[model samples]
Each structure stands twice: as structure tokens, then as C-alpha cells.
Target: MKKIIAFLILTQSIISCSNSDDSADDNQISGGKYYAVGSTYGKNKDNNFTQLASVWIDGVPTILSNTASSSVANAVTFYNNDTYIVGTESLNNGNAILKIWKNNTGESLTDGNHTVEATDLTVNEGNVYISGNEFIGTLNSSIATIWKNGQAIRLSDKTSEANAIYVYNNDVYATGYKIIDDKKTAIVWKNGVETVLTSEQDDLESIATDIYVDANAIYVTGYLRNSFKSKAILWKNNSPATLSDENDFSQANALFVHNTDVYVVGCHIDTHQYDFVGKIWKNGTLVKEINGANPKSIIIKNNKIYTAGSGLDEKGMNDEGKIWESNLNNLDFIAKYKFPNNKVNAVLVK
Candidate 1:
């Protein structure tokens, strides 16, 4: 189930323009200068990895942790006027969970009791919403769920899952897939109602991987499978737009919209094997590749774009995690560290 997928999911990182060395001197307008939020890992063989929520200011690292433990933070969002950083902590226990830290106060909103694991979180109008799967029976069944103020709101009563979540105009949107008759169907949930964004036509699996919200639009990004390959897709208001040009396997994991422009990051696999090349698309146009990049989360702040993800090494382990700043007009690795092959799920500015 999701537990298996969570272990296999590649981990990913982040760096903002102000925090990047190359753009450290760039005189650009920003939101009074905020720091990027993400995690860091030590080594794969270590008993546990430190799930870090960091703040980078002028290319310096500021660590934020409520408690000292080896937890993996999947996503982070700054809301309620940047007073809180909401994300999930993979406890290494059977149950991973959704927790919030109030601006480096070392205080958690969860109260450190329940093991409710959250993946993606957002703050809207003083309200907090997080998306991820919750364990049904001591890590037995993971139900697709959303939590509002630490209260569970189940999306699928059965063995279903929801991963990424966003809030717009007082409405919540989440995406993942469901198991129906032993087949997976791509789905989106809005205020507890499920909508099938893609069908299980001909054993072609489609997953609604990421969700982005704007003033008048909602963008969903993922992949649509076929007999030969899986193509990257972006859904704007439920309308589909294919991104990949070649007949290769391309999947999008992160999405963002700014100033009426769309931005997405993911990987495109080579025809031979699991060798995925990192890809970033702007407004459905192919921009560039990271050569062997695998992006996990993307964000837009201060009129700049930032991405956090990892890439494969010669040993085939996803060890190198990178962060890029777009407004600086440079796509260079801001930070790189060694860890197990993990996936970075979210990014934010604090």
C-alpha cells in the first residue's frame, strides 16, 4: 500500500534565490526576504534521518525542529501570516503523521500524541488543511484523508489514499488514487467529494499527483499511461494538456501557477530503463532538463520559482538533492547532500 510506496519514494531539497550563492548578490524585489522551507538527511545507513525544516537567509542554514528525532518532512507551507510551518513528520514508527511547528517556538500543534501523518499542507484564511493517508489499524490500512486543525476528515472510507493538497477560496482540493475492484483510478477530492480525474481505461494507470490553485483556476499534474509509455499531463480546470513530446515515460510530481503562467517539474524516463531525466515545463513548453533530475516539489514566491528534488548517481541511488532559483534566471544546484534514495514532497517560503 502507501507504506510500501512511501519507503520507495525518492527523497528530494530546496534553496531560494536569496539563499543561493549565485543569486545572493542579485538585487531583486522579494517579500521582505523570506527563507525557503525544506528537509535534510544525514546518511542512509543511519538508524533514522533528521526531518529538517530549514530557513536559508543570505546563503546560511537555519534549522527548525520542535523535537530532536529522525523524521522525514514531506511538505511545508507557511500560512497564518508566516507564524507557522505546517508539514508531516515520518516517525519511522508504523504511523507517520501531520504536525505543525509554530515559527521555531519548538512547540507543535499536534501536541505530539497521535501518529496522524500528513503529506501536503496549506494555510487559507487562518485555517490549516493537510493532506495524506491515515492509518486505519495500527498501520494496517491507510485511508485517504484530510485534516483540518488536527481533526481527521476521511476522503475514502475504504483502502484509498490522497497525497497532495491545496486551498483556494475556502475550498480544499486533494489528489491521489483509489482502489476499485482491484484497479487504481486517479481521483481528486473537493470538500469531501471525490472526482475521477482519469479513468482506468485499458489498464492505463493515471495518477493525480499534484494540485495547484490560482485566482480562477485549479491545475492538476500527473501522468497518463498507455500501452507503450506514460505521458505527463496537466489538467487545467479539469481539461487535459499533454506535456511530453516523445514516446517516453514522463510523470509530473509538482505544480505551481504564477502571474497566469504554469510551472511543473518531474522526470522523463529513458526508453531503456528507469533512467529518468529531470524536466521542467513552463506553460506547457519544455524548458530544460537536469540531465538525470527527479524533481519532487515546486513553488513560486517573490516572483521567483523554486524546485526541490533529487537525481540518480552512478550507483543508482537517488543521493543528490538539489534546489533551484528561477527568477535569478539560473538553474544551478543550490544545495546538495547525501541521504537514502528519498523523495522531497513539498516546498515553501518562510
Candidate 2:
């Protein structure tokens, strides 16, 4: 099941600002720096679609890989003025290889021994930490794995996957889920110690997509299945706080903590229309919504909220990467960047 979802989930979507006072120039704050990594699709001379791994810094895009094979840049971070990107590349043998790129130089993390992927990465004190999973055994069950400076650390015995990673005070934290009795169970690992975040008695599926740790709290955001629908949730120090109504299926993809407030970004599926609507919650309250978008990552800096994700195209057949900036006071979109024919997976603001 984890493998199925891993192959299905592509990337995150868009918010349009309506206020006349909100202009595109309002999003362009002086001296503000931002970085985003993702995959862009382009047509080749043969009229074939090709995937190009790319990174964008301050609205400028740099292609990292544009070969015949498909590639993606899933996550990006900066350390000591160097940019690092993590994602997957397709090999000629039809195997997916996990890769890390620093300053446009590529490093293979997997030798195509098995299907693997790098979901998120963080750099702390010159040490690079990555969260992902590798298939093992004949069943091809995913194992939750973290790499510290290229060293592998397995955090789960059963089928699992790590979607996000964070390093705080030299402690490694990963958020994902493990399979227990064929049920998805949300979990957070701190220094290789696992703590389940969802209730076992519910027998419903749950997953933790992202994790954030501040001086005062540890926050994880995802969703828990309830009967016929899923509910978005934010867990702080193992305590669950529901962020969406149980009547609709919703999932929180990422979260950030600023001062005393918690911000979460994700999407909710409308049962009637089957449309996915992007949403953001502040301190467990729904504060914004974007039609035809699904938010994946968020950051709050200098009293501004920046979110990166994807938005459905006019035909609703493809998704395009988008970044939205909003003022913290009114929460209205001030500026937005759209990458047509691409999907954004992660974002960083510094």
C-alpha cells in the first residue's frame, strides 16, 4: 500500500488573491530570498515528453538534469551558500535511482539495487540528512530509512516510508507511517526511537507527511482515516488536533511553527465533485482555501507566509507548480509564481 501511494502521489498546487490591494508586486519583497525544487516536463524534438529536474532561486530556474531519462528534484536546502537537491532518476535498466545534487553536481545514493526514492532533505551544521525509503524482501515492502552524511539508518522493521526529515539540536526526526496488521499507522521517530501518533483502536489508516521541531514543541501534520473519509490532523507532542471535518477526505502535507502559531498546508477532497481543494490552517483553524490546488510545503518568514505546491491546468489533466506569498496580517495572496508544465515538491525561504 505504501508503495502504491508512493508511486501515485506526484507533487503539490495554487491560490489566487482577490483583493484589489493585493498586487503581484506585493509578493516581491526586497531582499527576500527563496528556493524551490521540482520537475518540469518539456517536449523533445521527437515530440516526446521528457522530464527535467530543476531548481529555482528567486524565480530563476536552473535545470539540473535534462537527459532522455526522467528525473526529478524533490527537495532543496541551502547550507553555507551551497544548494543541495534530492530526488530520483530513471536508469536505462528501468530502475529508479535516488540522487543528491550539490551545486549542480550529482551523487547517486542508490545503485539501482532496488526501487528507492528521496523525499525530503535537510542540512544542519554541514551534515546532510535525507528521508526516504527502499524496497526490501520479495514483497517489496518499503523500509523507513534516513541517511546521515550518506550513512543509512533504518527506523522501522515493518513496511514504512519517511516523507520528511528534520535535524534539531543534533537529534534526527522523521515523519511517515508504518504498516501494522495491514493498517497504516502514523509515526514519528526521534533519534531512531519510534512513537506512534495515531490511535490503534480506530483501525483506520493514518500517515505523517511532515515534521517540525521548535524549541518548545514537536509538530507533525498528516491525516487519519475515519470510516469513509480522512481527516486532516496536526499532532503536537503526540497529542492529535483535527484540522478538517470528518465528512470530507483531507490530508495535511506540511507544517511550520512561527512564534506561537502553527501553520499547516494541504488539500481536501470534495466527495460530491471529487475535486481537490487546497487549504491552509493556522492554529488548527481554516484560514485560506484555493480551488484546484494542493499545497505541499509551507514557510513563514518576516511576517509573510510562503507556500509551494501545484495547481490543476485548465483541462484538469495536468498540474503546474506554483508558489504563493501572502501577508500575515490579512492572509491574502500578495504574489504568486507559476511554473507551467511542472510540479513543485518542496520550498525553502531564507
Candidate 3:
């Protein structure tokens, strides 16, 4: 079955945005210093591959960790004026490990025995919450996990993984996919209690990519997949709704909920299979489509929509990391930024 796995960690650049102007009108875009996360890649002097986990402050990259093998910076969060980023690094010995960096210095969280995925993260109440999976216990099946303050907690009983995590009222809510009855099913774990969000029937697979919680409801977004098509899905209060067409390849990467409306951002591959179209869905309806590249993360603040990752230029030639500011009402572009790399995995606002 097809899967729409949208995880943020760097393939290229970083992003950040301070609070926007309070008087710019609900539909206007305004911002201060912005921060983002992603990875930049190149060849080392030995012609070995190299990927640097990095964070961008004011659009300038600060390398987190450099390895001649490979390292990626995927998710970033700004807390107490410090930068926190998480990703993976492949060792020369062939073990992939998770790396978490704070203000450029780093911490290696694993023993490099099993493959680890550092998909997304959040800094809450002086503790770090990271969602991903690790392969262990002989069969090497992926096991869903959460690392809180560097301590591992299991969230699944079988082959599964978590894509996103959010903490509200001292409770942890995480989402991803689990192998249920031989089908990949979307799941939500509330403080480690299992709650299957997507149907176990009518489809071969599903993934829950991102989640948001407010005072009244829990909103989760991802995609549902079958043999031929992948459609975006939104789960609010355990009720599921399709956000994209059922006839195409589409996935919701992230979402933000405000008042009575929900904003979802994702990507769909074009029919030709060469180009990716970014998409925005509001309240289960498609409202905008961004051409040139895929977007991985989104935030709705001050009536402005902030989403960033890597995208090609207007000429469709140069690949660059970019953060776009758009009007939340009309979904019109207001500002755009281009960085030096080709694959940016994530964007976050301060």
C-alpha cells in the first residue's frame, strides 16, 4: 500500500519567525526574526557524503553536527532563547543514531546498536519530547517510541511509529501508524493509551502525521492510502474527514486549529510524477495549492499562515529552502524567502 510519510528534519535549511505585528490586520503578514530547521548536504574532502544538521537564525545557518557520513537536522523548537533540534546521524560503523542539539552543542541519545528515527520534537516545561521509532528485539520491526528527557517510552505493541507529539495540560498525545490486523492503521496514543483513529477497513493503510489539541477538541491530520490512491485525512474528536481527493496521491503533513477553523498543509505529487504540489485545506476543503515543491510543516498565527521547507524557484530549476508568509483569509502569498539548499525538512515559529 502507498504511504504518505511527512517527517521534518533537515535535507537543507532552517526557519524561525517571531511574533508578527499586532496591528497588521487579520489578513496581513508581518514578522520579526524567524527560525527554522533542516539539513544541508555536500561531499567531504575525501569525497564521502556529508550532511550537516543545522538551524537558521535570521536566515543564517548554524551547523549543529557535521559528519562525513551523514547527519540531518529535522525538527526545531525555540525555548527560553535557546535552539533545540533533533535528527539522525549515520555512523561509519553503519549504525544510525539520534542526535539532539541545543544551541549548537549536541547530545547523542542512543548506543548506535539499532536504527533510530528522530522525526519530530517539542520542548515543553523544560523537558524534551521526541517522537519516532527504533528497530530492535531481533526481528527488527519498527517500534513506536517517545523520548522524554532522554528516557524512552514504548507506545505500540507491534510494528509501528509515531510522527508527531503534542503536550497539553501535562498530558502527552502522539500519533503515527501501527500495523493492525496486517494493515497499517493510523493511531493516537494519549499518554501511552492506544486509540485507533482511522478505520481498519475500507483501506489498506493510513498514517497520522501531525496533531493539535485545544481546550475543546483534539485534531489530527495525515493521509489514508489504498492500492492506487492516497488521500489526506483529518481526525477531530475521533471523527475522521477526508481533506483531499480520493483519486490522487496526497498527504497532510501538519495542521493548526484556531477558533472554529482548522488549517492543514500537505503535498500531492502531480500526475506526471515529476513535480510536487503543496496544498492547504481549510475545514476539510481544499483552498490552495502551491507549486514547485513539497511543504512539510505549517503554523497559523496572527491570521497568517507560516509553512516552510524546500521548494524550487519560479523557473523550476534551483532548489532552495524557503519560508512563505501568506494571508490566512484569501491564502494569497505575502512574502517568500529563499535559502541556499535544496532540501529543507521543517519550519517552526517562535
Candidate 4:
């Protein structure tokens, strides 16, 4: 059976920061401090392409050590003033290796023996948890896997993949999907127990991209495919809430809950023009939209909302990493940072 791959668009757009300077060693990029992790690509002297894992501290770019092959930094977090990034690095034998960077030092999670990718990461009480998928056997079927402190735990029986992970109250929650009878089913695993979030009777394909837990409530965001279109969906304690209609293709990539209000950020695809429009929904209401960009992750700091991802450049030809900030007092974007030729998969505020 052919695999049904789910693509995630990571883009965002807002005003450029005025404090950007030409200094290469500056610790801050846009007058404020923020950390972002992603990949940077360039052409070698022989005109061949090369990629490197990169992390930015307050806008200062730092290329990670492993340059043997292409690498990507997928998620970033700060725990006890130490930075951590999770992603994958390619080996010479054509296998992808899961790797984590702590304070700019790279630690390989796999010995390049199997294919693995770390999509999201979280740290709780000094314990690190990373979520993604690992291929099994010659069939290469994906198995949703979570790694805690370098220990691997499989979460799925058949073909599955994990996108986001959260650890709350000493319980680990992983959000992703599994192939049941050849159809993808949205699921959440709490302490290794599986809970199906979508029903087959809906007659639509679904996926849960990100998960969050607050107190006693659990929230998961993604999209449901209905015929030719997809609609963004949010599940609050297993209750489904539609964030978008069936008119267009949309998915929620990340979400945050603050003071009983839920905020989700993702992308809506315009079929006619093939454009990806960044969107943010607040409590099931459309809050913001931007063309040619996709919001990947969101966070609330100091009562302000910030989203980090990638967006089309001014010429609309190439994509660049960007960060956008907003608040309830000002619904409009307040500040932004753009780094050319890079894509930010995650963001951390200090």
C-alpha cells in the first residue's frame, strides 16, 4: 500500500525588525532575545548543494558541528538555562540519524543503523522527551516512537508516526496517527495507552499534529480530510471543534491554551493559486491570516503571543524563517524577525 504522507507547511510573516544589523557576532537579532532551530542550505565550491543544522540565539546564527551530510533541527527548548534541539542528520550510507543538541553539542540518538527522525521535543524536570517515527524491517513501515533520555519506546503497532509530544504530571502524551485497516486514524497515547480521537464513521481522514494538556483537559489540533478539502480541527477532551469550514484545505500545526482560551496556528491552502495562507484561530474564531506563509508553532510569554515558522521573502521567490509577536491589546503583529534562506521549525523565548 502506498503511504499517505502528511505534509506540514512552516511559514509566517510580519514586519521586519528595525534593529537588525550587519554585525555577525551580535548575540541579539531583533532588539529582543529568542532562540530558533532549523536548517541552512548553500552551494559548495563545486556547485553542489550542502545543508547544515543551525541554531540561532537571539538572532545570532550558529552552524552545528555535524557537516557530513544534510541535517535539520526540528525543535528547540530551554531547560534550566540549557538549550536543546532535536532533529535528524543524514549519514553517508543514506540513513537518517536522530540527533539532539544540548548547548551546541550534538548527541546521536541512533547509531545510523535505522531510519529515524525527531519531530518534536519537550523537557520536564530535567528529563528530555523526543517524538517521531522509526522504520521497521524491510517493509520500512513507520512506528511511532518516543525517546526519553535516549531510551526508545514504541507507541504504535503498525504504520504510524508521531508529530508532537508533551509530558505533564509525569505522564507522557504523544499525538499522531496509526494505520488501522489501511486508513489513518488520529490518536493520542497517554502513558502508553492509546485513545482514538477520530471516528471511522466520519468518513474523513484525520491527523493530530500537536497536543497540549492543561490541568485536567487535553487538547489536540490537526485537520480532517473531507473528499477533496481539509478542515482544521481541535479536540478538547475528546470533543471535536471545527475551526474551518470544508471550503478549503487547512490544518492546525500547533496550539496553546491560556486562561481557558485556546489559540491554534496553521495554514490554509488556496487551491486555485496553490498558495499557503497562514492562519490563527482563537477559541474557534479566525484571528489572523497571512499570505504565502504557514505558522508552525505558537507560545504565550508575558501575556503576549508569538509564532515561529517560515515565510516567502519580499520577492516571493524563496522562503525564509520568521517570528511574529502579538497581544490582546493589539490584534495586529507587533514585531517580527526574518532570516533569509532558513526555516525555523521551533522557537524558544528566554
Q: How should the candidates be ordered by TM-score, best one leading?
A: 4, 2, 3, 1
Q: Which ten residues in a row have the lowest lDDT in candidate 1?
A: 13-22
Across 157-178, the per-residue lDDT of candidate 1 in tens digits comes to 7767776776666778788778
2 against 3, candidate with superior TM-score: 2
Which residue pairs in candidate 4 collide? 11-294, 11-310, 12-310
Show pairs that collide, candidate 2.
Answer: 12-309, 12-310, 13-309, 13-310
Q: Could you arrange the candidates by lDDT from highest to lowest?
A: 2, 4, 3, 1
> lDDT of model 3 at residue 287?
88
Per-residue lDDT of candidate 3, residues 40-121 (tens digit)? 6665445665666677766777766665377777777666677678888877877688888887888989889888887777
TM for every model, in the order presented, reads 0.76, 0.87, 0.86, 0.88
lDDT tens readout by residue for model 2, 1-350: 02233212321111110000101211222346778888778653345678777888887888777652778888876666677888887766666788889988988877887877778887776788888888888888889999888888999889988878887777888888898778878889999999988553376688888887767788888777744667788998888899998676788888877767888888887656556788999899999998887777787777888888877776787778888898888888633788888867777775
Could you tell me how far off, in angstroms, the CA of residue 243 lies in candidate 2 after the best superposition?
0.5
Q: After superposing candidate 1, which stretches have Cα over 4 Å from the reference?
A: 1-34, 42-59, 62-69, 89-93, 106-115, 226-228, 270-274, 312-318, 328-345
Candidate 4 deviant stretches above 4 angstroms: 1-32, 43-48
**Candidate 4 has what TM-score?**
0.88
True-structure RMSD, every candidate: 6.3, 6.1, 5.4, 6.5
Clashing residue pairs in all predictions, respectively, total 15, 4, 18, 3
